[model samples]
Target chain A: MITTDLVPPRKGSTMQFGIFSVSDITRDPTTDHTPSEAERIKAAVAIATKAEEVGLDVFAIGEHHNPPFFSSAPTTLLAYIAAQTKNLVLSTATTLITTNDPVRIAEEYAMLQHLAGGRMDLMLGRGNTAPVYPWFGQDIRQSLPLGLENYNLLHRLWREDVVDWEGKFRTPLQGFTSTPRPLDDVPPFVWHGSIRTPEIAEQAAYYGDGFFANHIFWPKEHFMRLIRFYRQRYAHYGHGTEDQAIVGLGGQAFIAKNSQDAYTQFRPYFNEAPVYGHGPRLEDFAEQTPLSVGSPQEVIDKTLTFREHFGDYQRQLWLIDHAGLPLGTVLDQLELLGGEVVPVLRKEMAARRKAGVPDAPTHASRVKDKYGDAEPRQPRPNANRGDNVTGGSPYQDTDEGVRASLPEL
Target chain B: MSDTAPGPAPVRRELRLAVVSAGASDPSSTRMLADRTVAAAGRLAAAEGITLRVDVVELRELAQEITTAMTSQFLGEGLNAAVETLRTADGIVASTPVYKAGPSGLFSAFFQILDNDLLIAKPVVLAATAGTARHALVVDEQMRPVFAYLRTMTMPTSLFASTEDWTDPALSKRIERAARELVLQMDSGFERRVREESWGSYQHSFGSAGGTETGIELDSDLMRLAAGGQA
Candidate 1:
């Protein structure tokens, strides 16, 4: 019999399985024909929809401004997908918080929140590109500050009413408000994404937000240090114990009926993938990085090993698309993932959790309760009127003045 | 009916402006920067007694389109609208956060897909937000070069701010100064271009490249292959 102590249970039913598409519209080399941007785009939509249909929790899309990569406007793409799908949480594989203006980020996401019906979240990163900054009139040196300041502003924009703000990087505002209030009176959750930046982990912990260690490229040790640092800082912030701090991870893997066939079929594609080509051995990558090439059980076993280092996190997003693999091969991988991999993983995880082991990261688990339940619940306001309040304005003076008049302890 | 037409019909001119904010938060600093920039543009429009139609595109809600199936339609239309409006606009106020030593990936991605000629000669006011006073140089070190590459007539005065600056009065003054300079530049640029018939005519000459389709097929077979017959 399998020892329950060896495997841990998850926190909630919301299993966070995400499918990320690189958004390259190029044709497969094996086929010698590229898909139109339209077809590639449609394929992305179908994939996301299928992820949801298969009961996978989230769908993320990467952002690449260059040609062959069709996705340049991830938010606009998510909004369109939001209109078509339901329940499946929408996110970006990498939302460049470094180059884009925080103001546009605020306005666009608010609009998306309205469109997505609150099924939205984002992973903020500075990105790996160098030439992209000049294309947008920005310097690489300012990347860290831009992420920090922009995220700060983004946070306030979602939580505050009117804003009176001034900063070194941007102009000041006496009273500013982004339009299209979020659905259900709640702003979308934020997950700070980072590969090597310990600062990002610190920021996430400082704000009591989720830290997503997209471990697609780095080794487990690096991610462990970052996650551990975040957990320690989260406790420092008086939010909770290290174990209670929310975390997420990113992984990449492929599975087949047999381990050898999985590696054989995946080797060429891995060797050619623009993101990972000419870097390291596929086996090495699979060992150090989150890239797992094997059967369904292998993927499960490898993923479960994450707990040994980083402890329990709130979510896990997987990158199943890379190296311009043919759509057929990708679908086969997904089928194996959804049918064989996820089921057994879920059962094993649950069995472990039932025996008092730790659980996976989840949205509900990450919601920081700053205030105790002793505080009276506030009534929901009219959706239209909610947009009228300004950030700096005294809420007590507004139409819902009575509720806004509540005293802060 | 007169040839002179009563002193050039009072020279009716309208200023179109586009303000892009890349933050996903409501009361975000980038939005504040955009507001300050827009207010400055509004002031310039008021000084010139011109009607200004401002269009603000917030990037957070729109970022999903950067990666998903909507790349071809909604995002395309949205970007087209933004580009067309910008091509016809007199000014632009672009704001973003500095991430990983550059601008946000979403903001950069948005600009990456835009046609190179769309921003040429447009008066752009650039601003950035970061965590520390140290990161203030991103506007100059990072954002300015991108605007310059687009051949935009970027105002020399760019604003950078950090957490400490958010509540500082001096930062507000700097923003005001940038706003003032932007207006002056817009006024001079608009006047010079109008006299030479350079603004609207150039845009007309270089109308959007609605060229014939490339007829390239994204390998549906590869997509099927990638999907491994799951579809």
Candidate 2:
């Protein structure tokens, strides 16, 4: 039996470690077999379940409208994973803020938060796929404004009872109350994930949200500058000190019992992976990027260096299941991660992490933050005002004297 | 408008001259032409008592890396170094051998893959080398528009050297004229002035210039929208 005894117990609040999948349906080059969509979907569910089984803390999935990626409906998949696991925090590697309607995001994720008992969060990204914009009636050139406006609306949808919103990207909302108000009336925490965009970082800092850097595929110098900017801006916006800012990072690693065995095993996958395939040599990629393909100790050593570059971060999500690695290989990879890599990383990180650094944001901590010792607000819709539009005070506890305004007609 | 602070006096001690030559062979004529143009430009700058430090980005050496960057978005060491050199360059000499009556594909691909905002308002001298004078218009007709799209100031004189022109005085005359225009543009400090005065007006993304354009303008419309204000 693979025991998780080495896993660091959650001590009030500490760093959270997990795996994030882009839900890619790549062909396994070793076996020359491609998993069908149905098979890949099942594999994704298994991966999330296995992540929780091995004492991992979070499971985040990506959003893609294109083929070769199975996760178009992240909440549906995450909600299902939520039902299967007890302690895992379900999230999205990124939800397309540029393309998806924020109303749907507010409603769906709020509902997922409720279903998962507030064990959920989301990372917003302006997706790289340009064609996805027009399919959703958006222009890619305006993605920055579209993302900022959508998040602005989504932020208020969870906080305000009834929102009257007018923005450039979307139609106006008059007395609109997004239903199934967030679990315990506390919205799921948000983390903005960006590879290079500072406006996204600025957006994250402006709202005091977490900033997640997808730390794979590129050198650390590029990410270091952006992360530094985010931290300073977070402090500038009065969220907290730079060190207290919540930061998450994404990485890719392949580990084994020995360094040579790990490299030999992963060479085919590295050379054939979709993103960097037929491009850089495996050894060069391993040397230049955050990709760690070596023994568990080696992987752990490389991962520990992240804190040195980015400073004490909160969440670290790895991309272990992509590049057409079989389900068995992925499970073994997770076992190594949970049984050896993360456990050691946890202790080392905990020892080195400075005092006053915040842990990854969670629903329980956020709700406690909101309520303190008092009872949390339970929003109850007021009596129907005879139309689809909500009253000025949609909920009973909005205010004593607030009322709806009718047209002069 | 009133918030603009004249921060520090612009530094103009040494001008960076980046020469991007797309010749494939060793001691290629394209590079020779580029070298001649650079030498002429250097002489003009020395006459003005300005130091011109040159950085040559031989695209032939970076051919594989450029293709890799285009395909995988992974910039190798050489390509990144070249980008950095070009990013800091005050003036540029772009010399490409005419391939099938056009600029070399490798040369065009290098600039095509760079961030659109990287070369904004920078001065460039366009030169092309071909086997015949029939392809002389290639620099004006083909390349000027590409540099135009990048918002670079292509010098008024375009340099083209055919097999015979290399031995002719007219080629020397064109190079001298192009070099003069380049030195004048660089000495004018046009790029530094525009970037210092109006960097925000140009369309830019974070990490555009090899991750150097990280300035956050808080007063932008997008930043306003980020702060929950109307766009």
What TM-scores does chain A show, candidate by candidate in order? 0.85, 0.96
Looking at model 2, residue A1 earns an lDDT score of 21
TM-score of 2: 0.91
The parts of candidate 1 lying over 4 Å away from their true place are A1-14, A353-409, B1-231
Two-chain DockQ for model 2: 0.56
Residue range B1-231, candidate 1, lDDT tens digits? 001111122345655667778876887988888787667566555666655567777777666545321232213335545655666667778999888888998888787666555666778889899877778788898888888876677777788888988788887787887777776667666534642464434432111222111111223432222111211
lDDT of 1 by residue, A33-62 (tens): 677778778878877777766667688888
The candidate that achieves the highest TM-score relative to the unseen native structure: 2
* Top model number, lDDT: 2
What C-alpha RMSD separates each model from the true structure? 25.1, 5.7
TM-score of chain B of each: 0.73, 0.89
Worst 10 residues of 2 chain B by lDDT: B1-10
Q: Residue by residue across B180-230, what tens digits does model 2's lDDT show?
A: 999999999899999899877887676666665546667778777776777
